[model samples]
Target: MDSPSTPRWRKSSHSNGDGGSCVEVDDANPGHVRDSKDPNGPSLAFAPSAWNAFVSAVRDGEFSGI
Candidate 1:
């Protein structure tokens, strides 16, 4: 995992103003995800391909109504 200090973390645009159900991603390094509510907590990293697939599934609503 990359050092959290150097990573450029950005909150999702979809994030609520009150900070509910939000995620943060580090564009400085691809494939890293951290909870917006817990910036110092552990992050989950994925391969670029895997991350794309995950995003595609999300856009397609594969997990809708779950």
Candidate 2:
């Protein structure tokens, strides 16, 4: 799908200053994820509901320490 117009990238709050596994997300269009190290690289877009579910899972520690 076409990239959203001028997506405003926001750095993840969980990102450490050492730059180890950082992620950037586009709030302009929810569910869009791009690597912080490669802003111009490909992005993964998910449906809003799916994204919410994924976030919920993360919050619930469904995928922890793996």
Candidate 3:
């Protein structure tokens, strides 16, 4: 994995324009995620396949109850 500085982060499209909870993603880095509220905070990174599976699950409503 590359250093955090190498990942160019962008806010998730699903995030609300209002001041709701938001997450930023580094698409170039596959699974890097950081809170929009805290860009300088810690980030969580996942394996590419794991990230894709999680995204698919979310889109498929597998975690709707959460």
Per-residue C-alpha lDDT of model 3 across residues 1-66, encoded as one tens digit per residue? 456557888999878899687999997788889998988899999988999999999899998797
TM-scores for all candidates? 0.72, 0.80, 0.80
Q: For candidate 1, lDDT tens digit of each residue in 1-66?
A: 545456889987756788797988888777788998988799998888998898889889998776
Q: Which stretch of 10 consecutive residues in model 2 shows the poorest summed lDDT? A: 1-10
Better of 1 and 2 by lDDT: 2
Instruction: For candidate 2, write residues 1-66 as lDDT tens digits.
Output: 766777899998867799888898888988999899998899998998999998899899888887
| Candidate 3 lDDT for residue 24 | 94
Q: Better model by lDDT, 2 or 3?
A: 2
Which is the leading candidate under lDDT?
2
TM-score of 1: 0.72
Task: Answer with 1 or 3, whichever has the higher TM-score.
Answer: 3
